[model samples]
Target: MNPLQKRCLILGASTRAAAQSALYAGYHPVCADLFADTDLCTIAERLPLQNYPDNLVEQATSISPISWMYTGALENSPEIIQAISKHHVLWGNNAEVVQAVRNPQKLYQVLKKHDLTALHLREFNHPPPANSRWMLKPKRSAGGREVTVWNREAESYYAESHNKDKLSTDYYFQQRAEGKNYSALYLASATQTVLIGLSAQLVGCHWLNADNFTWCGNVAPVLFSHQPEKHQKLAIQAEKAGNVIAKEFGLRGLFGIDFILETPFLPSSFPQLFPLEVNPRYVASVELFERAFDVSLLKWHIAACESFEQSQQEEFVTTENYSANFSAKAIQGKAILYANCTFTFPLTIERMPNCADIPSYGRLIQKNEPICTVFATGKTIESCQKDLQERSDEIYDALKIKE
Candidate 1:
């Protein structure tokens, strides 16, 4: 079979990055996503998801006979996965695995029973203590949408202010854990799981108009050469917890573990790390891995899925093997610039490297909508962050959106 004829269908909220990676891996990508932006259209034939989960299979069939992979929001609905798997080769985690990890209550119970690092979580049936700081998280949501503080001042008015029945099972509360945010990315086969890379997740950058927990981007190699031993220990702990979760849930292909180190960078006392949630799909950080190691992550992801099915791990390269090839060439980061107010794209769009999810010209962008994605790569984290800020400024300035 000709490799170019191996059509890979990609679906997600926005599949530009994955589509790009698929092209790099020598596959003909047929994409169905929310934003068929200019960049994505340049790479693959666009298929419209006319009715979403219901139309997913039909839309895919409309394109060609091909294997499919999904991104962010699709994992929340396992029924959709099952439905799609009936017709197409699904290249990621299946319905059963998604069910195990997507349920917050079940995941919390597993973490507590296994003696893994975890935060204090409570059911929404009862109100949290009036004095304690708590966060209300949707049972099934992503990219930090709708995550907010459970304000004590509004405690008494909870029942009167909202629907009680919907609150019980739709959401839960957790005592806010203070710490430095990080994510551990890994690959899993049926027999074993491999830790791939660690990254510092960028959340709530004010410049991007993102909320406190809204995911912005990531910087790979969380622990640089000069970091202390304690930081390295944290990374190891993350891997240990990741391995446990992958085995527990039978997670296959690409997965990420969100974590928090309970203290600042240095001068810490009694630092504890807590594992947050298990993201059982390809995350934003995969791009960072591809940039740092000069390898196609999407190809590895597809390969991992195939390898897991055969129960053979020999075909896959270990994370350590990839790490050995890593050099201190440059640090890379990607930031999503969100709109603070309504605006329209300028007449002339400036071309930028790694920029994606671009809004079309003359289109009205709403408040809080993502304007576009910008990227930066440098010899140091500081330099990379600086570059991101400058590029973001340029984007906002061109669109006439203010802070």
Candidate 2:
């Protein structure tokens, strides 16, 4: 380690990009996460975490005296964030803000007061509407991992699992909204916020063989309509809602808001956008924004939280210009490659283009295990989707393991 280089520790379910971003900002990144992929290992010091929150404090203490930041699932566990704060400097929101935004009832009330549309949610005690699909979402969770449709038949099934306790208090049923999923990413300081980018979320992709509501990836610079005017209006609406949430919650650093666009074609229609929840932390779509906009939101995220002397803040451009630029430029997307069946890691990969999150060689991957991430870009969303599909197909073919 260079004596002069600042050291930063990144903790999350996956810290690959956070580590990379730290390095980009000239900091030595130390990472602890579930998968210590080869690419991540190449650039940063990797610490394999057996169990989170329980073991995080000990592991973090082992590498003491370094500032830390969390990426994905850790944001959902404010207690863990608080524990880490006792030993290290946290580079993002404090535990209080995390707790505030994660409280579904409070969040819903706040957003509702601001006229932001959100799904009708209720505690588990409330009976679900008959014949209507409702999703059971775990509080303090991310990556859509245990989120599933609610039903009486699944009660016994859940009762048998270790998550039975979580069902009591940390879970609730939400009325599902019909629409295309979207997310608004932004950077915030104490006083103001800036819209970083927008993404069309990839949910439950058939090619990925993921469950319904499972987050696959994102396509940045989302086009809501063919007409440029409506597209800008939709962007403005989403951004306005995001800014309100950020300011209302006093959210600082890089945060993302998940939403559903019920009417993508008719952007001018009332209640076209319904915000689902606020992820007051670094999200999966940050990588997509960095790729599409040729900007480093992560760098600014750190700067926004800390008192770093950053040169030239990221400009907040007009929504019209933002939408027009996205329409004119290329569209980029990423796909999380999941294993269809249990198999040993391949000794060699063939022509696997734009792949990331690679598991270690000789490691056995179980069914539905996320093997890696694949990325692609093109002139349009459809073409980008096709390109990413092709790349994913090439990887599966090379692996040659059927579902």
**Among these predicted structures, which one has the highest TM-score?**
1
The C-alpha TM-scores of every prediction are 0.92, 0.89
Residues 237-257 of candidate 1: C-alpha lDDT, one tens digit per residue: 877887788888888888898
Model 1 spans > 4 angstroms off? 1-5, 51-54, 153-157, 161-166, 264-270, 307-312, 315-325, 350-354
Question: lDDT by residue for model 2 over 1-403, one digit each (tens)?
Answer: 6677788998888889778777767788899888888889988987767875578878988876767889888877788889889889878888999989888888888877888777788897674753447778888667777887776666655667785665677788788777788888887875567776678888888788677778888888776457777677777887788788888788988888888878545655654778777888888887777667665666677767876432333343333223334433468898887888899988666235588888888989998778889999887788888888888888888899745
Clashes of each: 0, 0
- Write down the worst ten-residue block by lDDT for model 2: 314-323
